[model samples]
Target: MAQMRFITALLWLLAAAPLAAQEDARPDLSIREPERGARARTYVLASLIYKDAEDGIDRFPLAVPELIQYVEDNTELDVRLRGEDRTLRQLDGITLLYMSGNNAQLRIGAEDRRRLGRFLQDGGLLYAEDVRPRGLGRFRFGDAGRSGTPFDRQFKELVKDPDILGAGGSRWRKVPRDHALYSSFFALPDGPPPGAHQPGTITDLEMLEYRGRVAVLFSDLNLTYFWGDPQAHSRAPSLRFGVNLLVFAIARQQAGPALR
Candidate 1:
């Protein structure tokens, strides 16, 4: 009886050991990417100077806060908002670099331009918007009160492939009804603001190849204007476009890896 009792206790101990080991093991959540098999790591870089009210520019409010909400509602991708205190070296970990025109000071410099070139070459996707003072397309940098259209001159140099952007310099074109972004991520009232709308046409779209990686760089079509405004619930069209742009960014990144 004693020997049989001891054997029973030993079996219990052995069974519990595996469970204990599993509990002790640290889960590598870092390697996990977004849902739907998205492997791209997304990062938002914001400049400190852009937020300073003393800079004369009306520090626009569209930024990481809005991005966080979008990510929470949309995808499971790991997203982080980085500031100037961080090193440019850490940029390697990021697959998508969101350049909200909020950081005009950083985007306009010569040395910074060189760094941006290398970043794009190393498979980093850029989603740039001209979020000038006042409203989304109302303020251009240096040129006071100028309409904040797409930063054409700079992108023209980066996106050398003419096919990326149509004959005109607009990076954002009307996303057609049959486009992957329209069906997969957006549709009708819920998707990209329908094909028959005013600004939903794909007038200026670009699929530029940089460092063997094709990137779809685009403007948010007045997205920043609608952000952070509680009274603007009627702007469903703008919000849908914002969501579509994100889906497009992630989808474009995945396209390269799939072909490989």
Candidate 2:
């Protein structure tokens, strides 16, 4: 039965691929800043560097611009398109960190992991996605023992105990349907947008909350690819979801308390 369901979902995605392709054009890279003298917020695309994963940073080229445009067009926040790729150690004033890669064996040092932990504990949000090709060492929830790629293993290590948010036994779990993140800026009634990565199964948008705010938002489905074409019909919900994430993170940061 599970196999049948997977087959059906694959077929559906295949059927929709052509339509998505038709709309897959380069997005408008020009960023429109608010007339106000200085930008209010800046989103960072933290480029993950791993000794084993050299090409990891090359996956999502359009993600930064699309996210920048989406936030500016839909909200009153004065956001800037500052997509400077930086290491985890340089996360001083950054509020949001978007990390995606294809390597499963990716590794980060203990010091960098501690730095990331501190950043999240300081009211920062980390949005991570694994973009490994479907059949090739991709990350599957139940198959973690077998299919867990390097990124998967490293990510799990990074969020383990004594890491600030992950301390006190905190862990990632399914984001409830009614969570504010689903409806912060745009209503995501059906949860995360469907992508070629995971078809039949609902791609779980896992969250790790500390105190009363979410510190990490993770998806195994390479959502960065979903931000490919801003004008694509199927890309709207995904883009909106991205905006909602940014809005939620910013609101929580301004609410004062870092950890309850």
Candidate 3:
């Protein structure tokens, strides 16, 4: 029965994906200043929720679910979905931050994922969203422009905060082509398969190596297109790249030092 349900879902998605999605469908995010009130919290429990929502509504919400369904059908893992939001930074002994997800292995600790972006326009750095906002491989799927996205402003604001950056310097650099991530599950000789992947026009995935481990991974393209694209299940590079990324997360965790 489970197998049948899974297969049915896949067929439904593939049949429903509109060709318009193939266009530049990634929404341009209108990330405003973090509102003055107590604030609404958004945390992704991995497969359940991939995009972050400030007003409780993500621009393109189909990517994560489509991606999750794609993973289950193609891979052996059966994911348990859970997506929610919670308070942040309130701590007893100097606040502690952690991220949680079912599909993606937990990084800092357990249970807490804000939107794909914590950085917002005119707000404190890294402190805006999830815990330990260090650099990482990141992307703003909403807008493709190199600059002027809400995430760009928010991230820049976070970078300025000394408390946020902590002692470790920004080891920000392009993920080396030979890094294990490229070939974690499937081999991509070039690099991250772009969402709006166009010939001669692409961006490298970036990462923040804090201490001896990779703290963050970022992408600028809306690789989400692959999630719902009709060619997803086939041999789409974006989908394959997404799979490679999730697989690499486990590999990265295994290599990181013991968690506190």
Candidate 4:
């Protein structure tokens, strides 16, 4: 275990260094388009299933694939979900980690937290959601049930360690109605369209920012459920919002940032 401890210590040192010089330590989590006149690109999106997560981790089974199909249908990008979504114990090769669940007691062990830290330092986006069961929006189970709400202290603890996630001391805020996320791809003129939950439960999306980019975005909208259920209300807008979110997360890398 001597080598392992040495490597871990090295990673901590790298985290304190410049983002540019972190190439060797950081995981490669970039999604960019091919060069002009070159072949188009393909992306594989997946959800994170952390350890000790028995329930809610895979709730709304059809959510991810449905969202992927929606993105491909509406945008120029070719996106597909890994088979049944990635059953990952590690974050290697993941540019965006879609972590959605409503279980307030979600528990991630120490090792996975370190993996997340390295992933964020590598410039990955963690898009979390509270996927309320169909027609069960009110089952919020009080504050803890919501994945990313400012009041969900349990979820906050998951990422509170700056030494672990490089985002210590951060807090969620109401994403302003004028935030570009509303119009990244589709035009959300009035801000995020209403979520699946009851009206006004959330006036806007909440985000945790880091390194000048959105490190985590939490929503109580039950968006994935809406996308999966074909008969659900506001299904179209939900899919549209999904596309906008995916585009915004990777747009910076698509611009050919020199970090990689």
Candidate 5:
């Protein structure tokens, strides 16, 4: 009765959410940096473990090192990649958690999920992605389709489940052209802004606000891949887009009670 279990879990989440909401209700303010270690300019938590589907192509790509360098090079912030020893419970000092898609899955169990879910509900942002998947119109997962293409099944589960992060609303829209990602700080003069998203090209990417504090950002396109390529350094438009996202997440995370 997997279906029954799923339904039961959903109901339990719905029933328990309001009480958790009230108990953790603090005015959306800056979370104090934890005292244990030297403070990073910006603490970024990345899920490094990845499980590729049987498919040949990757559904998600883990690009932690690439992303870390981008943040250091492009912004004033010093970002630290969280190790596995720590749990979400140790997130107090961190400003943002970057979920590297490369087939990454949340390691939390059934009970701990409620806490992580509540963390996002209580205003903690999680930036995640679903990298390119395999098994499409033509290409199979592998030799004679023996190995299937990479597909991030868990990622799909999290995004579609409203009880997990409350981003299932249709209002969770893609970042439009007007978003600061296309603004001057990143792109040089005369360069065109990132092109209009190709029709139906914006698959699975989303942005949504919760509890007036946390903002969840997801994209299928790999910013780390774009940032990691040495050739892309001269690609101002793409670089700008990458930098914009990094800054936007930081600024959005730090904004006070009014931000959504």
Candidate 6:
């Protein structure tokens, strides 16, 4: 009887171990409310679940808070940072969805893809960034190559989905240096900042335009890391770039039928 009880206890602990690990993997999904009567723009960071891999979301936990502080301090925009780390199912009223990860074959179900499609059609903007650190080397643009980073391959898969940005003949293309987004708030005369990765070549912001509105923007330079440690790295320019993106997203939403 004593031996049987000991074996049962051991089995129970083994069963609970995976559950504890899963709980630890999921970050807090709490939403921070804005000040009373403040017309705040909320940015939601998407926490994705990759198949057979540890959670790759929330790579730079400090990125969002730093961005919120920059926009509020430098601009008149009422920026509000909220959401602990949310999943796609919790993204109903979110205006801007920010996603970062490094899973090569990251997969989103068909239903989630449809939901994301509707979000863009309703004037929401999706911004995705490759969070892989520098010195990792470049991702192969075309064809399958082992040299490419996981994020590079995942980003390609994300924008190529027919139900997502690829619908209605939409596709990702480089944002022009003279585009209004470059000058939306702060003038990015030189365009995106040079990071450890993709140094000196970060000229244009990649965009996916649908019905004349930029529905999605992708960056491979790891801008989030710049925001992660602004003071330590003197990342004011990268913060400015983030501000421009938020301002541009709001403007597009206000443009309404003009965007069509």
- Tens-place lDDT digits, model 4, residues 20-68: 4355865666634234334334444567665444344335556667887
**Cα lDDT of model 3 by residue, 58-160, tens digit:** 2223444565566666765333432223343222111111121111221221122232222111111121111111122553222342433455344434333
lDDT ranking, high to low: 4, 2, 6, 5, 1, 3
Model 2 lDDT per residue over 1-260, tens place: 42233233333322222121123352333534324446555545454444554442425656767777766665555445466566777887665688776554546777877887788777677887766432354443222222256665566666774754556324768888877677655668888776545455546677776655677877775666657444445676677777777656555544433423
Per-residue lDDT over 219-241 for candidate 6, one digit per residue giving the tens place of the 0 to 100 score:
77677767766554658878888
Candidate 1, superposed: residue stretches over 4 Å from native: 1-59, 71-90, 102-110, 132-150, 154-178, 188-207, 211-213, 251-260
| lDDT for residue 43 in candidate 4, whole number 0-100 | 46
Best by TM-score: 4
**Per-candidate local distance difference test:** 0.41, 0.59, 0.40, 0.59, 0.44, 0.59
- TM-score rank order: 4, 2, 6, 5, 3, 1
Model 6 regions more than 4 Å off: 1-58, 78-84, 134-148, 167-170, 198-202, 257-260
CA RMSD of all predictions: 15.2, 14.5, 17.9, 10.5, 12.8, 18.4
TM for every model, in the order presented, reads 0.49, 0.69, 0.50, 0.72, 0.54, 0.68
> Alpha carbon lDDT of residue 86, candidate 4?
59
Selected candidate, larger lDDT, 4 vs 5? 4
User: What lDDT, from 0 to 1, does candidate 2 have?
Assistant: 0.59
In candidate 2 the C-alpha lDDT for residue 69 amounts to: 71
Model 4: residue 7 alpha-carbon error in angstroms:
40
Error of 2 at 64 (Å): 1.3
The weakest ten consecutive residues by lDDT in model 5 span 140-149
- The window of 10 residues in a row where model 6 has the poorest summed lDDT is 12-21
